[model samples]
Target: MFCLVLHSHLPWLANHGRWPVGEEWLYQSWAATYLPVTAVLRRLAAEGRTRLLTLGVTPVLAAQLDDPHCLNGMHHWLGNWQLRAHEAAGMPSASHRDLGAREHRASAAALDVFETRWRHGGSAVLRELIDAETIELLGGPLAHPFQPLLDPRLRAFSLSEGLADAEARWGHTPAGIWAPECGYTPGMEIGYAAAGVSHFMVDGPALRGDTTAGRPVWDSDVVAFGRDLEVSYRVWSPKTGYPGHAAYRDFHTYDHDTGLKPARVTGRTVPSEKKAPYDPELAAVAVDQHVADFVDTVRRRLRSESERIGGPALVVAAFDTELFGHWWHEGPQWLEQVLRALPEAGIEIGTLADARARGYVGAPVELQDSSWGSGKDWRVWAGDQVQDLVQLNAEVVQTALDTIDKDRDANHHGFEGDPELRKRVHDQMLRETLLTVSSDWAFMVSKDSAAGYARDRAHKHAHALREIADAVASGRDEVARRLADGWNAADGLFPALDARRLPVRSAETAAFAGSTQ
Candidate 1:
């Protein structure tokens, strides 16, 4: 069996900012990736394709998608896209004008889809796919924090709350998670088992023992599926990948006049101005060839692994969901073609959940700490490049927990304080703390992709957390309330979050000691 997993995630950006980053990032991904990808899934579902694949949509991204503010913003952004296309049509270059016309039509279609289907929010759209059993939805923590670096109490709290949020939206709790960056520590399986997570993903090196099949972790029944890099990298990588094909639209090169891509990749080292004009027809041909090649690769790998294991084997290929239409313009069409072609080629396709139920299990193994980042270690997040951000996160988490504990204690004393007011303050503190710990800012800074922007975002959240904590501690109830309300209105993503669920370290420590048997 072949299980394809796509991890879809973006940090909480709604009401934070927009433009070259922020909510614009969400809108571009929605119009270019989410809408098109889901359209493909819906078509397959209409033809009764069950267990198509496994998709992980993080709680933070889910909250933003479902937010009315984001929905309205996305609607406006699509209109802007249409307007840009119209402006492009009058460009002096014929190719540029054609590109604009094509984009204009695409924007129109997306606008229609959003107004008719997605106007309700992303949950409504995803829920339809889940209800149809077209895809197995995987949930992750409220924010995509690097779980291994988090305090154990926070880890448990985040996972539990995240799964609960998924259930509230989709009516089913995910049995698996695409762990943030596939980051794992040795003892995480205990937490997974406790949270009712039956399976999760990891980098191939984490299994050190074998990468052919899902291995039961340590002594827990929870299974760990390792991504097959050999297969996944064929579609996307830093060096060679299908999107870099000379015939495909150049992702980096955009026309200055209309801000639309009008050239093909042309050559690996070719300058933007010298690149050949994009021919969608040529790109279509490349897509067909790549689809056939991918199917054959999967077939060959599955056959070889099955023989080696003395039985049928499973090959899991995973990738970031945004890589599809967002990065590679023709990626959605290629994906739809691949999904349709694989079944007819006698290759069985199913979700990770389906693969597990079919008994694709191996002996238990102790996995090493790992992630899918550079060196397959924690360097991308905990490395020297971003040590300052790491320190900020540590301080923010501790301060938020301290404030929550202080409020809990005051409530226990039956103080004259309004319970509702205290809860709001605690909730806002937790929100800012989670935003501060998001793995995105550290990653962006470490990669140097948007270091300044990333650093500013991380500090912004941390500052909010500190101010709320200080206000609460200083007995300035009115000041604290105002700060909490303002931040809540700006950065709030998870409306279902209950700050009371966060674990108090002192109580959790005693509970851990009691459960050691």
Candidate 2:
């Protein structure tokens, strides 16, 4: 049996009143992926196929999915997609008119049911699938931290809070976590063990202590599964993934005339206007071919391994869930069909937990700090453009420590009723802190995708923390109130952040290492 792990996650883009980056990203992903993916699973269940695959949906993403504001936004976005598709279908006889009609109708129907089930509280359709055992849901830390780069206490608090939130909503605590970006560092196993995580997924290289994929590896207490890069990469190979094939819709090129996304991925280097129209028949053929190639690859790898190890070998294929409906367009359909085809051809599909149950453990070893970014280094977060934010983070982190040390002791009057609020503050601080620390920001800066926006957000969060520290320092209620109000205005996602419970450190840790405060 091959274990297929789909990690679905995004940061908390809530009703924090932020835009162009935060909550909008959540709604966009929801419309493009979440609702569609769930619908796909529901259809599979109806076909009598017992859907038992592992999925890691981060708490931050789940929280937004369940948020009243986000629910409303997604409902609106889905409707807009339906209308847009409808409008596109009416345009002049473009090559993609038929495809547009089918897509528009399907999207409208799906949204109609999704809105009906998402009753302002819980996503009933998703709940139904979970109850039916079609999908195995997993949860990860709040804000999806690059764990290996996080402070020890911060890591514990984030994982603990995330797990608790999962238990509250999903009715079961996840036994495994998908480290954000598979960012693994030495000693992270201790954190996973503390969080009660029995297993976590890492890249193939992280397991072998090298990029070569010859064997599976494990830590002292946690089991690590590597993505079967050969099979997994086939669907989205570096250059010639299914998305870049000639028959499928081009993700990058959009038609400005009708506001419809109508370009096809002609061969590499072909301009958008020169490409052919998206032909569903041709795409179906491509999906079929890719599916066959993927199945054969998995079968060969597993059989070869079984021959060597004298047992039933497992290949774990992992991917970002969003890559399905959003990036690849026809990705969700391709996945559903591929899932069925693979099993029919003798390739068994299993979850991470299933692989572990079959005694697929590896030799114990420590992992190095890393991410799935370019060069797989820490430069993404700690790079030059984001240096100011890093310095600001250190400063505010120190200020938070000093506040805790000086005012928040056994006799602290503000710690009692404020724990939840304190927790909110701590969590939000951690969130912004993590966001500011995200390797993506640096990568984006390097790639030049609104670097100013990323930099501003990073520093803004740091500034908010400084204000919080100042309020605590003066014992002036008005100052704290104003700063809290400002944060509330800027970020309404976490209203319960108690300014009092923010962690405090000793004078030494509070003091700057090389720079003066």
Candidate 3:
């Protein structure tokens, strides 16, 4: 069995910056990757493909995809793409004009798809695929926080609320999750089972490279499927990958005037000025060749593993969804072709869910703290370079949680003091708290890509949490309410996030759900 998992995510960018960093990241990935990649899935589904892959769209990213602000912005972005193509058409160079004409047609087609299928937001489109059983949607924490370092209650609350958020959008709760950062702690499977999550993805090293089957974690029913890096790295690696082929469009080179990539990757070390024009025909030929190679790779891995394991073995390849159109211009095309070619090569493809359902599982194993990051450990998120963020996360989460405890204490006393106001304030504080611990910040800082922006976002959320917590602690209800309202106007995504719904006592307001169920 072969399971391909695409973990789709972007931090909250709705009310954040626009030009170089924040919302631009969202729009580019949505336009270049999400729009086209999902279209591929939709097209394949029309041809009657079932369980094609497991797609994990984090709750935070899902919220943005369905946000009215992002919807309007994406519509405008598509229209602007058309305008830019026209600009390229009027350029002095003939080759540039050809690129313009090509982009214009592509943009026009995208605009039509956007206006028709995406006007209502991504939830509808994804829900259609889910209802059709074309893909298994994996849910994650509400804000993509690093789970291993997160507070236990906060982790549980985030997971439950994240699943609830997905249920609200698609009318189906996910039984599997692509745990944020693929981050896991030793005893976390108990929480997974509690949240009704039966399976999740982990790095290959987490299973010590014996990743031929899903392994039950620590005697629990919850299963951990390790990515088969031997197969996965063939599609994306440092020294070699299909995306680096000379015929594929160069993701790094851009025609700045028209904001389009017009050159093929002539060579790895070739300068931008020396690159050749992108030819779609040549790219198509390369995709075919790469698809054949990948099929052979998977076939050999399966044959070897089946012999070694004494039975059929599962090969799981997991990657970021943005790798396709956003980071690799010919990625969507290659993906479509590969999906078609794999089955024709006598390969059986299904999702992680199908693997478990069919008993493609191994004996229980006690897993260690692991991530798909540097050294397959927590260094990217918890390294010495990011010590400040690690400390800040601890302080922010503790403060937000303490405020909730203080609120509970007030209710314990005679002065219950505006139940609705207290709930609203605590909920917003928790919201900011979740944003503060997002793994993106530490990741960016560690990788030195937009490090300043990452630090600013983390500090900004931490400041908001502190300000609101201080207001509530000082007995300033009106000030706290104002801050909560203002923050909600900016950071609000999950409408069902409530302080009462957190892992709180049943007598407080309502019973904590999925904790004991």
Candidate 4:
């Protein structure tokens, strides 16, 4: 069985900068990836495909997709895409005119779809597919924190809250999760069981590369599905992938005047100015060949893996949802064709939920510290270069936990204080703290991809958290309320989030956590 997983996620970028980094990241993914990807799923579902794949739209991304601010901003961004296309039409270069004509058509379709269907936000589209059983939706923590380094109490709280958030949007609480970075700790399955998560993803090496089927973690019913890198890398890999094909549009080569990508990836290391113009016909041909190649690769792997495992095998090829259309302009087309072609090639395709229900599961295994990042270990998040972020996360999380517990101990519901104000203070404090714990900050810093912005964002949220916590500690109730209210104006996404709901661990659990990392 072939189970494809697409994890859709982005850090909260609502009030962050626009160009060069923040909300621009969100808008670009929304327009270039989310819109087209969902459109493809809907088209396939219309053709009677059910349980085509497992889609994990992280809770943070889901919140933004449904937010009023993001919805309005997305509309404006689509309008801007059309304007840019029009400007490209008047450029003197024939390649510029061709690119303009193509983009104008694409942008026009995207804009109309945005206005008619997506104005309410992406939940409407995803919810429809979920209800139809077209795909299995997956959930993750509210802010996509690296669970391995997070405090156990906060970790459980994040997972439970994230599942609840998904239910609110999609009308289905996911039983599966695309664990942030596919990061795992030895004892995490206990938290997963508590949160009612039956399955989660892990790197292939975690299961000793015998990722033929989902393995139960330890003795619990919670299962960990490992990504089959052999098959997955055929499409996307660090060294090479179909995206680098010469016929595909070069993501980095752009019509600077119009901001449209107009060149093909003529050569891997070739400069953008020297690249050839993108040809849709050539791209279509490449897509066909790649699709055929991927289907054959999966078939061969399924046959070999099944024979090796002494039973039918499960091959899961997972990737970030943004890889489609956003990074590889032809990705959505490739995806649609692959889903169609796989079934015809005699390979059964289903969601992760289907694979589990069909008994494609193995005996319990003791998983270890792992992530799908570099080296397939915790170094990407906990490496030396990012030690400061690791320290910041540790300190802020501990402080937030201590402050919340102290508040409860002090007033037993804040009898001597404004109860509503106290709750708001703690809620916003936890919000800021959660934002700080996002894995993106350390990732950006380690990779030097907007390291400065990542640091500024991390510090900004850290400052908000400290300010809010301090006001309450100083008996400044009104000041605390204003501080939380102001922070909510920016970091607002999970509207129903409550600090009071955050899990309060017992002494035994806390001591265990202290003894570990």
Candidate 5:
């Protein structure tokens, strides 16, 4: 059986900004990726396909998708997309005008879909798929933090609360998770087991290069499935992938007038101005060829592994969900074709849950620290290039926890005056803390992809946390309440988040503390 996993995630960006950054990111992804992807899944479900694939929607992203603020913003963004497409049609360049017309129709269709269905929120759209059994939903930590770098207590709390959040939205708790960036450390299995997570994904190297089947981790029944990089990278890779095909629409080169992509990826070395105009017919042909090639690749891998293991083997190919319609315009179509073609090719399609339930298990193995990022290690997040951010994260988390612990202890004995106000402050502190620790900021800084923006976001959240903590500590009740209320209105994502889930200091440790002014 071949299990395809798509990890869907975006950092919490609600009310952060709009053009070229925050809300725009959410809307572009929604119009291009989520709407079309869900439409494909819905079509397949209507045709009675079950357990088609596994999708991981991080709690933070889920919250943003379901937020009324974001929903209204997305609606406006789609309307703008249609207006831009219409404007493009009047461009002097005939090629640009044709591309504009095509985009206009596409945007119009997407707008209609959003208006009729997604006007409510993404949760409603995803819940329909879950109810239809079209996809197995995988949940993750509250903010998609790098778990290996986090404090164990915070890690446990985030995982538990994240799972609960998923259950609250989807009616069913996920039995598995696409661990943030597939980052894992040796003892994380204990946390997974504690949180009732039976299965999770890891990079191929984490399993020491053997990814033919799911292996029990660290003597626990919790299963860790390794992605088959050989088959998976055929669709997307840094150097070469199907998306780089010459006939496909160029992602980087945009028509300056319309802000729409009108050129094809003529060649790796071709300059944007020199690139050829995109031809949808040619791109369609390429998608078909690529889909057939992917199906054959999976077939070969499964057959070879089955022969080597003396039985059927599992071939799991995973990728980011955004890659489909957002990064590569034809990717969603390619995916729909691949999913439908694989079944006719005699390949069994199922989710990770279905794969595990089918008894595709192996012996227990101790996994190494790994991530899906470059070097498959912790360098991307905790390396020297971003050492300052890493230290800031550690200090911020500790301070936030320490402040919460102090408040909880005082309130426990009725010493701290207003329990309700303290609780509100604590919840806002956690929200800021989680936002500060998000893996996106670290990753963007390290990769130099919007490094300044990433730094500002991290520092902004940390600053808010400090203000609230200091206000609460100084007995400035009105100041703390106002700050908390402001932040709750601005950076709010997880409405149901509870600060009590955070681990408190041990009694022995707390006894050594004295009241401070």
Candidate 6:
């Protein structure tokens, strides 16, 4: 029985309004991917099937999922989809000329089924399935920071907070975490062990020198499970995956002329939608073939491994949760069918935790410092184009620490007097720090998708923190009040951010930094 762990995550996309970039991308994904995936699990569980799949919804994304604003936006978006479909179906031109119009109508009706069945507080339906042991819920750090590059103290604080948030929502802390982007280093195992995580997922390359998954990789006290590259790459490889086939829906070719998605996955930029509406039936046939091939591959691999090593063999297939329903269009259907089909084929479908329970052993090996980014290095955050932001990040982080230390030294205080004031400073500091450290800035800089926006945001938040630190250090209470008020007006989510909770930079911490600040 092989464990198939799918680590699903997106950075929190709320309130930082950037179209084609931030919060909207989040809501679209929630409607297209997260919600639908959960619904599929719910349906499978309803049929008296208990399949194990690990879903790591990051704390930031989780907060947005349950946030009232995002929920309302999702409701509106689904309803709009329904309205648009009906309106298109009713048009005489669409009815008379577009043979695909009827399909659109059917698609609309299916979406209606989705919206009505799962939109309003309906995720709890899947939550109930989780409660019933139908799925294993995984979680990760608050804000999804790239852990390896983060300060150890900040990493510990963020991961601990994430665990607490998961338990608050799901009623149990996850035994494992889907480290943001499978971002891991040898030293991070201490933080994971400290945070009570028994295991975490890693990309195959991080474990095996080559990414051909043949064995488990252990990083000190924690167990590292490698993603089965063949199975995972089949779905979404860097250059070509199942979604790149000519018959599937094209992600990038939306008809800007009509604001309707008419482009098909014609493969290699040939624009297949100009030919015809992608036949969902054909897509379903493709899904079946892919599933059969995957199942056979897993069975053969496991059988060969058992013959060689004399143990119950395991294969872990990992993927981004967004690939389903969002990119492939038929991906959710494929996933549902695959989940249902795997068991009958004698391949076990279970979460990483379950595999650990079955006693999968990690070999004594040291893991490379890596992430699932380009070049599998910290380039995504510390790349050349983003060098300025990196420097600003270091500067702002130092400023925050320096201010805290100075204030503490003078009065031996964290945040005194007003609870709300202290909270604001702490929350603002965290917010600025997170915004500064986002991998998106580096990704955008590398990808050149609104590089200016990423740069501006990083510097803006850095300046905000630096100014706040200066205000506090100078005993300029009025300036501090003004800066706090400005931040309050801009980023007001953590209204009760008690700055008092921020620990002072102790001599030990200072000793660790070697007079840097």
lDDT of each: 0.88, 0.66, 0.91, 0.90, 0.88, 0.68
Query: Poorest 10 consecutive residues of model 6 by lDDT?
Result: 209-218
> Ranking by lDDT, best first?
3, 4, 5, 1, 6, 2
| Model 2: per-residue Cα lDDT over 114-155, one tens digit each | 757664644355567667877766677666766665555556
Model 4 weakest lDDT span, ten residues long? 413-422
Clashing pairs in 6: 422-498, 422-499, 423-497, 423-498, 423-499
- Per-candidate Cα RMSD to the true structure, in Å, reads 3.1, 3.8, 3.9, 2.0, 3.1, 3.6
RMSD of 2: 3.8
lDDT of 1 by residue, 1-517 (tens): 8989999999888866786778888998998899999999999999988989999999988887888989999999999889889998877877768988888899999999999999988898999999999999999998999988877777888899999999998888999998999999888999999999999999877887256789999999999999887788888875788999999989888888767778999999999999999898999999999999999999998888889889988888999999998899898999999999999999999988888899888889888889999889999999999899878887787777777777777657555654533388888888888889999998998899878888988999999999989989887889999999999888777877888777667766545433421
106-129: candidate 4 lDDT, tens digit per residue: 999999888888998888989999
The better candidate by TM-score, 3 or 4, is 4
Model 6 lDDT per residue over 211-257, tens place? 22333335455777778777678678888777776767666765333
Query: Which one wins on TM-score?
Result: 4
- Native-to-model Cα distance after best TM-score fit, residue 225 in candidate 1, in Å: 0.5
Give the residue spans of candidate 5 off by over 4 A. Answer: 414-422, 506-517
TM-score of 1: 0.95
Query: What value of lDDT does candidate 5 attain over all alpha carbons?
Result: 0.88
User: Model 1, which residues run further than 4 Å from truth?
Assistant: 414-422, 507-517
> What tens digits encode model 3's per-residue C-alpha lDDT throughout 50-162?
99999999999999999999999999988999999999999989998999999999999989888999998999999999999999999988999999887778888999999
Residue pairs clashing in model 5 are none
Q: Which stretches of candidate 4 lie over 4 Å from their true place?
A: 413-422, 512-517
Better of 1 and 3 by lDDT: 3
Candidate with the greatest lDDT versus the true structure: 3
TM-score of every model?
A: 0.95, 0.87, 0.96, 0.97, 0.96, 0.88
- For residue 203, what is the lDDT in candidate 2? 74
